[model samples]
Target: MASVAEAYVFLTYLKVLFLTVTTYLTCTAHNSPTRPMFSVFTSYNDSLEKTHGLPTNLSWSQLASTVGEDKTSSSCQPVGIYSIQRHGSRYPEQRIITTYQTFFSRIARSRINEEFAYLKNEPLDRFTVEKAECLTDKGYNELLEISARYPARLFPLFRDPVSIFTQSSFQSTETNRTKESAEAFISGLCKECRFITPKHDEDKLILVMKDGKIYSEIHWLPILHDPLLLPKISSGICKDSIAIEEHSREFYSFKNSPFVEEVLHHVISRLDYTGDFSMTLDELQSLYEICATEMNLFGASNWCKLFSQSDLRAMEYLYDLQEYWYSSYGYRINYLPYCVLLQDIASHLESSVASGSTSTKKIFKFAHSTTIQGLFALLGLYRTSVIPTADNYPLDGNWEYRGGIISPYAANIVFSVFRCAGRSTLPNAIGDVKVLITHNEQPLKIGPCDSYYCDLTTLTSYLRSKVGSCDLDEICGGVVRDLPMKT
Candidate 1:
């Protein structure tokens, strides 16, 4: 046997030789005339700009045409606005990080396409285990920009900054990303505000003070185990097994479909993969996910170069299918879990209208994508006439749901209450208090309403009718644990 140092040197030389040969093969194959003319037709930036997939970055101008110029009726003066926003763009979850490491390792061991040669020694400093699931710098700025836009886009909601600050309440799920997102948003909303961190880690409420006076309060609620946001997990209103079963059936069926398989085959051919490793459908899909998330984090991704517009759309559809089945409009029970939250909002709106004060002027909750999707389902905002399945691709007017537009990072639902000049006998109104709801800064008409603005009492009554009397124990068929009382 050779000496230890000699053996180490010999192994290192072999490794260098292997990498050199691999690089040469990759470059040669890419330049070969036999190689198909397959490259990104639309640039990744343009593709991402047009993408309506779940991972699209949030922008204030995203719906400028669709929303048009500020359409708040001149006769209507804003009183209060209640909003629920998904946390801004965040780093990939731990599982995604782990899978990315594995994928890069596999690529390093293989003779990859020249376009993807960077994967052989891809630096993962941006997506370390320590940063898993935390909001990135880009994510913080997304929320900051969104919060700054409310004054102009939503208009007059923050006209009285002092009153708004004193009365408004901010809440978030018990997650670092959510809390950080809320903080970033508040920074833009209230530039001169001060925060009082809780003395105990167990404390949920944080006091907000301005000029030595208490301005408002921030509440951090439990996540995953929360009663209002994730009742499926908290109260067992929806069975996890059912979702899992449906997801598995669709996941395999769709991935194994002829269309999807053909796309996968094309990708494999372009990759010209030469290694002991065989990529599974799941791993292939993960590549799309990495491309999307990296785009969100850095405004671009090298992995995105591996795909064409069609490929991204196909991959997007897979996730769209997952969101449809798991979160929105897949089953009736999915909506039931959100009743408690809707009912709470109904009470708050009704009370705010009754009080007619800025105390309840702005109520903001920072939550997750699932929370927004489930809430939309509860309100019947986006529904499709045709069911999405592996056999069908509802590409035209048939499909109304697009995950990117509906529940993208920093997705929000806003209910702006306006005091309209009119003559009405409705209780607690000299004329009429109108409620205008918007999804991601664009008008979203509520159920059975022809226009974006609906009567506050009418809207509150409708919400109550849907879920006002929901009994968690009875609805869930089990005793639901309640959130601890705030100290």
Candidate 2:
């Protein structure tokens, strides 16, 4: 046998030779006339502008269109606004980071193919997975911009600077991200304003359940049951296991398709390496997640270049399906907590109307996307007529209606209540007050309401009718005898 140093030098030479040959083959194959050049680099910047699940960057014009032009409504004066907002972009969860690191380490140790040899030697310093659940700088800035722009957009409605009260979901252990988002929003609204971090006792605006105990800070007791309510009458409804399995199978089929595999192989083959190449489907998915999450956090990622727009759409659909089945309208229990939250909103609105305080003009809530999605589903916003199944995701389907679009980072829903001077057009008028609802800064019409503004009496009555007494204990804990799989 040769001495250790000689053996090391020989092995290094062999590795270099293998990489050179592999790189040459990859380049040749990619340059073939029959093969279309697939590169994300050319479109990466454009693609970032249209990423589905993360918050889409909006221009002032787009924001203006969403809130509508300040068409002078002589009869109505904005008295108060209630806004529910999702937290800004954040670092991947610890679990996601751990999975990504494991995949990267495996790639580093394995034999890399010619098409993916670049990955073997790629520096991971920029992609270092953060272990904490904190908001990225991008996330912070998104919130900052939103806060600064909102006052300007609503200027016509509320001419004077209004006092804002910011609140967030209360946890036994503090959620720093939610708090930080709330702080950023307050800072943007007015620099001198202080953020109110409500504890369980002071959080009367939103209901909180901890260890089977429900707490509410509000004193007004509205009727608890509303006919138009979103939560199931019974808790017997669970996710359809058959449907979930079918979805899984469909996802697997897509992931294992020749097109996807070719893309994966191309990515892996470019990684410079000396060993035999091998990668599992899970590892491939982890790589995609890294691309997606990194892009959302940092505005760009090289991993994004590994796939085309079609590939991104497929991945987006998969994530949408997951949220639909597990979080939004999927299971009966999935939206119960949000029901309580809705009740809280209604209670606060009613209280504001009763108190008639211009000093407390805005109610701002900061929460996770889970809260936003749950509330959206409960309100039937952007719901598909036919529930999406894993096997039947149509490429031509309405992408705008997807949950990814509805509850992206910094996603928000706003209800602006106005005190009007005219007689109500709506049935059972309670004075001349009206309410306008907006989602992601855009006005959203309630079912058959037709106009951007719904009569305050009509809106509150509808909400109260659906919400009834707004009792959390009864609604959350009540047992419905027989809940069907689908409403």
Predicted structure with the largest TM-score when compared to the true one: 1
Q: Tell me the tens digit of each residue's lDDT in model 2 across 1-487.
A: 4699899999999987864554343212322332211111112222223342223344323433444533424456566677877777666666666677787788777765555546666566544555346776767777787777665555543333332322212221125676666656655765443434434333233333333233222211111221122233222232212245532444565566664565566556555355465666666676676776665554455566555444555566666666665567665445644666677676656555553343345667676665677777667666777766556656543443355456767777888776666665544433466677877665677764556676665666666555555444443443421344344
Sequence-dependent TM-score of model 2: 0.68
lDDT of 1 by residue, 237-328 (tens): 44432446654455467778875775576567567756433666766776766777765555466766656554555666767777777777
TM-score of each predicted structure versus truth:
0.78, 0.68
Model 2, stretches more than 4 Å misplaced? 1-72, 111-130, 156-173, 192-275, 355-360, 396-401, 423-431, 468-482
lDDT of 2 at 64: 30
Q: For model 2, what is the alpha-carbon lDDT of residue 218?
A: 25
Measured over all alpha carbons after superposition, the RMSD of each candidate to the real structure, in angstroms, is 11.9, 11.7
lDDT of every predicted structure (CA atoms): 0.64, 0.54
| Top candidate when judged by lDDT against the true structure | 1
Please report how far candidate 1 places residue 166 from its true position, in Å.
1.5
Q: Which stretches of candidate 1 lie over 4 Å from their true place?
A: 1-72, 153-157, 194-200, 205-216, 237-243, 273-277, 355-359, 394-399, 478-487
